[model samples]
Target: MSEAKGHPPVFAIHLTSSATDGTRVLAVGAEGPLSADLTDEVAELCRTADDPGRAGAVQVLPRPLRTPARVVVVGVGAADPAGWRAAGAAAVRAARSDEKLQVVVPPQTSPEAVRALAEGAWLAGYRYRDAPDGPRSAEVDLITDDAGHAPALDRARALAQAVWWARDLTNAPASIKNPPWFADQVVAEAATRPGLTVTVRGPDELAAEGFGGILAVGGGSATPPRLVELSWRPDGATRHVVLVGKGVTFDTGGISIKPRESMKLMRKDMGGAAAVLGATFAAADLGLPVRITTLAPLAENAVSGSAFRPGDVITHYDGTTSESTNSDAEGRLVLADALGYAVARLDPDVVVDVATLTGANAVALGKGMAALYSHDDDLAAALTAAGDAAGERMWRLPLPEDYLEYLHSDIADRHSSPARGAASVVAALYLREFLGDRVDRWAHLDMSAPSWADASDGDLTKGATGWGVRTLVAWLGALGR
Candidate 1:
């Protein structure tokens, strides 16, 4: 409808047309003559182009054109469907360069598949390389079969920006992302958006509220701790969604100190928190008319004599006692406390807590996907769909009723971890206990696998991915007008 902030909507967001000037399409194909639609779109695009080269390399291009927006033909080479998706992402990046032209969508496949590629393109096209002014921005035109494309494109744009926000919040060094500092970032970021009310609960306030789990997690760190909440409510909002994110700035495994390599990526331990915060940024950005409240439980589980020991017993905010079986499991503690607080305070219609919670999840799902565990089948399916559309993979794991026995403790209400293997299952079951009997719609996401990349992949950039944000955002987007 309008340009981001400035520019007179310089490019019309359009589907692939034969014209390439003010309108252009991102094209890809097998090494053969262009398809009829592809050829026509390229021809039209070339007319708008001053240089045929910038027209956009995709399926193919015209030799010359009237205008200067050169053609860009993205080479699909010989890849299957997934290859096309990657090629589309590459096309978006290529088009963004050297000019401010609108790149059109050329979805030759299913709408969802094309949207997946577009999501990837929007994601890969991001350049967080900070300019003194900030990162450069580009305009994208989605070639769609449907008439109503602007709203969908806008939603995708919001989701992409939110992913970047999640990555930045995760990528910022531990020195820059401490608990209080993180809370401040949340306040400043959330305050800028309309209809968002920000609240910060300090350590004293947490203690007063019986948030022993959070207090225990953050007590060792010099940075103190906080619970930052961002809420958006329209009149008579139909759904209440509460998201609890683990905000451990860094994790040292506390008394159960991890190896040097394990601690290396600890700075990203709060990747889950960043995702929710980033999603909050998107929510505020899009002004989605849903009652979304995000709780970021901030902490740094450092190692000092003051650090909670492995043998220590913790009294949680819900008045449940937990015997710490392994100090590395501290993420669940902070998240448990946050979840407890969220369920108690908001009593939301649906509650979700995202965290880089367990290593077993990584072992189960690998780095490409996160494990999604929920009591509600509908919520699980919704999250799975969101993950696919957003290009984040999530596998729904069963929260078996029998698995509850592992978390039981002889001395306390629960043991911090299960006695045997399959730690991921045990971890999810442990969290289920914290939600208590009333909340039936709760789900836990173990983001350990997808949040951090071994390196950059097809569409993912190196470091923090802000994994669950898009899915959560998309699910929320589906809820309201």
Candidate 2:
């Protein structure tokens, strides 16, 4: 955890294949480097090596150029973010088990490539490593010649650190990351920064203020529920943006319990809250000018006698009634309350909510992409552009005004979920009811797919991918421009 300070060192890259100390990594694209740049020995090795550069390709040799003890050449086809990230991560795997290494930045490397390289190397090296004897790797160094790249490198490292922070929180066990603990962490973070204000509301206050969704779902657990509101307002900032995250510390599906197999990874159900919180921290770290507020509705959906039941009707913060036809559809319930509170109280110029709400999102976009649904085209475009720049791919899904009919309820205003297909779209539609014309610049990110990964790829580790944070931070940074 102490390694969270900064990025591993990277040095300025040179074209010559001279040997150096420790492990040295070289970047090779589809079109291999110029023949003149390689030493005679290294050039001969390249000829003997299988296909110099293809996507995700790597070739390792023992002192080919006679400088370093070992050398690795990684393929980065097309030099896109994914390719660069893979190359950086591949370098981590190719290095000595416990040695510090240097990575050679390719000539004419784009800013995005730099970010991908830093993010991949740093994230791949992350470990819970709380114990003294846990496996650890030396710092990674990126070689860069231009002093102009320093600022951008610093920003990239900060963003990667924030992602790592979120990943740690998401990977934590539910026993230690309950609602109160989560609130305390949020408060502790806010205390460290100026111009930031944090407010926590407990179960009693939530009940008094009519946050029925949070209360009902949290009632089943002894840990209770909490609402954390964080605001950062710098002087002269006129535009305000609100980010709402669904903080279900652990989800058991309440009265409509999930199967044993499906409940195993429920600890990551709060990935949305962690992601937005990470973005807030990143924005503060970068000193962005736009005002930002993050709302986290913290709760645990457990099974108990008092657990809310299907077919129960609850009144939300916006005075809208929703019937819980399926208790498993609880993420939207908490998010609805936060969305209403943000629009009614903060009146932000833009609103974006993140949640691991539905499996349908994974069914549609798979685990590598997040589903983005929005009513505002401009807002959607901006977010997509920001996501592209940050290497977080978000695919837009239609809200389908016609799909609103699926949420119809016989006894209440709407149903928590639809009975049949289009579950992801229906969930987004359910949240839209809370906006009620007060907010137009809004986007809902269903992070069920990209929130966690089964295996490590690029800079993302095997668990808690830290999905939405980078995209939101990038978007917030681009707000004024």
Candidate 3:
């Protein structure tokens, strides 16, 4: 866990035909001086994984002079940056078993490629070695150039590592990461970092503060709901940005119970919370001059006697009443309150909220892409540009002025969720009511699809993907635009 301090190290390895002189190079292609150390490390990595097979595409090498240092022969999948990063992440994991080793990646990679390598390595190397732990890989080595701006690279490392921390929390099992625990984690982080102040608003404070939306959604859970606020404004910072996240630790769909299979991955429903925290830490480590306050409405969406029902109408702190269309759509409810609080209290120039808010987003963006909703054209464009730079996919979805009409509920101020078909779009429109005319400057990301990985890509692992932090950090850096 001590390795959590910085980004993982990676080496640039050279592949050679005659590397068979002694070392079992898991050489995937031509070896050269640049990648020598990396090839040796990859061999060691493969050996450590302890698989009896070493398959390289169209390459033959003499077998076993010894344990074979885990021959993870990777194929030249594509000329794309993603492939190289996947290779980098794969190398880190495959070489991981040995106590602290370095895996080499492509040397002539682009800036984005280097970032992808670091992102994937740190992400893949993450292990929540803290909780009642057993045997695990102690640390990982990521090699980078000593030249250029070392300070900036160090900052990059910190940002990537912070993303790692956030991912670790998101990937943690629900048993260890409920509402109170999450609040404590945030409190601890805020306390440890300089230039940060945190506040935890429990059920009583929520009720007193008129956070009816968060209260109603989490009221049924065994654990009470909490509203967590983390503020950072170093000395003379200029811009202030507010980020809100839906922190439903384990959603049972409440009175609107989902099928068992549907509820299995509910722990990851808090992916938005993870993103906010990750972005905050990364911004701090990157030393962004902008002031930031992150709002994570921590709650466990459970099924209990106190849980709000489908027909129930609850009034939020913002004085907006919403009829429960489906208790499962509770994320948006909690987020609505958080967003309102952020706007009213922080009064930042811009606000953004992230959440695993809908299955409909998945239908529209599929598994690897996230859906971006924004009334502000500039905000949407910024986010899209950042996504392009960061290699995270976020396609913009319009929050049409007319779509707001669909949220009409004769019995209440609005419906918790609109009817099916255009669910994700309507959900965005629903949030617009709380944002009001200021919506012209705000953005919301429906990360339901990419919140959790269905498969591993080059640098992205097969679990909590740390999906939005890079794009978010990039977007925040481009704020004035």
Which candidate tops lDDT? 2
Model 1, global lDDT? 0.72
lDDT of 1 by residue, 1-481 (tens): 3234443322222222233576644333221223465456655654564433322224334334323224454533333334445655656555534444444444344454455555666776665644547653445655454555556556666778778777777887887779998888788777677788889999889988888888888888888989888888866778888888888899988888899988988889889888887887787777777788998888899888678887688988878889987888898888788777776767788888898888889888888889989878888888888778666888988877877778878889888876688788888888887776535798888988889877655567667777888877777777765
Answer with 1 or 3, whichever has the higher TM-score. 3
lDDT of 3 at 220: 90
Which stretches in model 2 have alpha-carbon errors above 4 Å? 1-38, 64-67, 80-82, 106-113, 129-138
Scanning candidate 2 in windows of ten residues, the lowest lDDT window is 9-18
Q: Per-residue lDDT for 1-481 in model 3, tens only?
A: 1223343322223232223468544443433423566455556554554331222121212224332222345433443445544544565655535434454444454565555555555666566545646533235554554344355446557767766767778888999888999999888876777777888999999999899988998899788999988887866777788898889999888888889999888888998998888888878767677889999998888888888988789888788899987888899889889887776777788888889889888898899888998877877888889887776889888666776677778999988776656898888888877886567778889998888876655556667877788888888777634
In Å, residue 362's CA in model 2 sits off its true spot by 1.1
lDDT of 2 by residue, 1-481 (tens): 1112332222212222222486333333312222343345444555665555454556765643334445567666556776777677777766654456677775567777787777767777777544659643347777665566677688877787788778888998998999999999888877887778899999999999999989888989989999999888877787999999999999999999999998999999999999999899888888889899999999999999989999999999988889997888999999999998888899889999999999999999888888899989999999999888777888999988888889889988899877889989889889988987654678999988899989877666788888889899889988955
Error of 1 at 316 (Å): 0.9
Model 2 C-alpha RMSD to native? 5.8
Candidate 2 lDDT: 0.80
lDDT of 2 at 459: 65
Query: What local lDDT does model 1 show for residue 251?
Result: 93
TM-score of every model?
Answer: 0.80, 0.89, 0.82
- Backbone clashes per model, in order? 37, 13, 18
